[model samples]
Target: MAGQPTYMLGNRNKSSRTRDAQSINILAGKAVAKAVRTTLGPKGMDKMLVDSLGDIVITNDGATILREMDIEHPAAKMVVEVAKTQDDEVGDGTTTAAVLTGELLAKAEELIEKGVHPTIIASGYRMAAEKATEILKTITIDISRDDRKTMGKLVKTSLTGKGAGEYKDFFADLVIDAVLSVAEETEDGIQVDVGDVTIEKREGGSVLDTELVPGLIVDKERVRPNMPKKVENAKIMLASFGIEFHKIEKSAEIKITSPDQMQMFVDQEERMVKEMVDKIIASGANVVFCQKAIDDLAQYYLEKAGIYACRRIKKSDLQKLAKATGATLFQDVTDIRPEDLGSAELVEERDISGAKMTFLTGCKEEKTASLILHGSTTHIVDSLKSALNDALCVIGVALEDQKIVAGGGSPEIELALRLSEYAATLKGREQLAVSKFAEALEIIPQTLAENAGLDPIDKIIELRSQHEKGNKNAGLDVYTGKIVNMLENNVLEPLRIKTQALNAATEATVMILRIDDVVAAGSRKGAMPPGMPQPDMEM
Candidate 1:
């Protein structure tokens, strides 16, 4: 019998595999990154991404765009991951990290094709990154503790045009202080607890005060004169949602076949309602915060009894309100509070066209301790809460540990350039990765050109020519509609967030690239990906 033999492409036999995983990752990462990067600098244009649901989101925010898009490629997934990591590390800066990383991989691909080993490139990249970090440190100015001016600028940037108006100055100081207070003062940068607190707009107005109350606020006084007139030192309590507790035999109404039985059920219900309210009053709870579900009888009795009750309290806003007023929550009225009470001016809901509820209790107008609401719509607010929560999780990280970078994109750019510069200095072909890194640095500018709809090729050539002629600071310059020198004048530098993001994205990408294959610990066939060398042993 004649046996057929198979030949392998490049350097492999039929049974042998090469770790082209890095190549694929780098390629995919760079391609998508390139597409996104083109939208950088002032020249960057907006992208309108419409999801399957026809929800259209338009922005150059890389994480947002990538997140909303229907991305499928595994490598592209990694690129998105880079953006995600950037976003996770800092509230802003995902785009720059993705852009820089994609360019790095792109340049690395060229070097790899030219015979540079992936390991060599990785090592050089590592060196360049370290150098970049050092250079960035030199440029970073510490935000003075008292320099409220710059701090105010950062806050204003976060709050302005978001319906914050003259309130910007007021809320800016509040937000900055709250962030600073939550975050530790360190040489690296100010740490902040970056969670999104709920803000609601209602028909009632808002109140600003720090005095803690021990009871609920009701629109009317207690229905009965016998009901205590505002129990002094009332213990305030909250509930998950509003509901009256009344026990009934299983299917009691079904068995009741006569009017007398029905009347008994009604009377029992009334009695239960009264008992719960009386218990709350007896517990010395002068106030209660609950969702709008008070039984009519309970409401009538509570009003006559003089309990301060605020109904329809948003579930989300309860936490901050609780924190601000020192109120405790109870599922049943029996668990009322005297010490849990807090005070707020009458709960007035403001009907701003968009969303406009600014709930501040126990803090002066100029003082910090305010919530900034993003994504004003009901759905958008929910989504924004999740996004802001992710941001907050990152803040938790800051709370738990000292972060390495203060700013995001600017630091990332600085780091990328240094890594590339160091690669240029390496002694041998190993320097290929370093040089590649430097080449990757071009991605930022290249992306800017792409986003601006300008000729990236031409801009690169122009920048290169200037650099070769002795322009030390040769980089991409993007403007609204044209390619301009970033160094030319008055170009707003990337935010501090990008720096931290770059480090995280770079690390994650490199880790994924360095691995030939991912092993599934427990599964049939060991969960090995195709076209990569499997681990010597499977778990």
Candidate 2:
């Protein structure tokens, strides 16, 4: 009994050690990569994802596809994380990151089969990733924020390969305008918060009907019919407190034993409501956006005062209003002062698609903007919004970093060439990993060519030849199937997209490769409760 080895894990626990674990994990990672590989470039196809509830989402956006997938394997989930990280950091290139991660794992599998250690492969990947990043920085082209032409190209590049591609030029101008309108300059550099740019979508019109608002749009209307439908030179007050009577915090009951006493109580409530409305008027606020309820009495009084009021506004919308109009949000009406009010050129209630919405345009300060997108169906509008968001993010990233690179898979080809050269200078088996990393990068161009119905091998050969001939920007044109200079063709993206994708892919791959063991506890799904009878399986 003393010499008997004790089981380190629970009886219900299952574990795969070393080679078995690595094999299973690597295969899972590769499978996930293959799932989204086809959704790669401009010529990529969309995937129709249906959830358990029967809702469907069709898109080529890698982030969306992987997110909608119900993945079970832990290693496969890591690949999905790569796409998510890319999307969060750069707002684009999710597919590229995912595909790259799969390729890296594929290569690592080869190394593992050849008796190479996972640690050695991971170290080589780290070195290759660092070298690839350096290579990317060397190839980036600097552009001034004032160069709208180049900025538009960057936006259009992100918009391509989706439903929005057909209207890229139109959407590009709108995205750039919206981003620059809210762009701020600080000690650090140009900072662009895409959150300041709101996107509102509606059905019933064509995508061309999309327009950018220089300020904000609230999906609400005036609280009362008699109130002014429009207010010029608006002084807006954002109130978190409701105009309704304040309720007691603790549970209590009032004893109104007589009709006279009940009337008196009602009169007192009216006075309180009037006083609350008076405070808002005294602040020189002709327009009120309340985050909570507005009483009937308060509404009547506000309408009589000719103030445009909207009740039950969302807290997020109120904050955006504060930013757009330079207004301060006041939780207590008594604390509101003339200085706390925000100014807008005009506040108007407009009927859009038979529904009333408030539009606040020409803010005192251009700190926020909005885009109203129109499409024939809800699905179309959603896809358009997704594409526009990606475009907006890439533009913001480009403005913040002021660096761009040729798109159309040009950067990947260039990175592959430079990394291969860098690998040559390294010694030992790590160089094999480095070279594999280089080869893995070529998967982008190959996938792009394959999706476009072109010969992937021929295209890669041509691209490599062009790069070797000093044509670093040469990329395959998915439309014409010709190798051309992406920079000259006006195909470009922010350098951040490529860097973020590479870092995320490498990190995910290295993590999956270093795994030597996997332990899974028995699922508790149908397990009987303690002391409960187990279901009979004899039948």
lDDT of each: 0.52, 0.89
Candidate 1, number of clashes: 57
Per-residue lDDT over 108-212 for candidate 1, one digit per residue giving the tens place of the 0 to 100 score: 777778777777777767766666656655654444455555555444433322223224455544544444544555686555545323322212122221111
The global Cα lDDT (0 to 1) of model 1 is 0.52
lDDT of 2 by residue, 135-248 (tens): 899889998779999998998888889989999988888998999998999999999999999898888778898989887999999999889999999999999998889977
Worst 10 residues of 1 by lDDT: 208-217
Q: Residue 144 in candidate 2 has what lDDT?
A: 78
Clashes of each: 57, 0
- Clashing pairs in model 2? none
Error of 1 at 411 (Å): 6.2
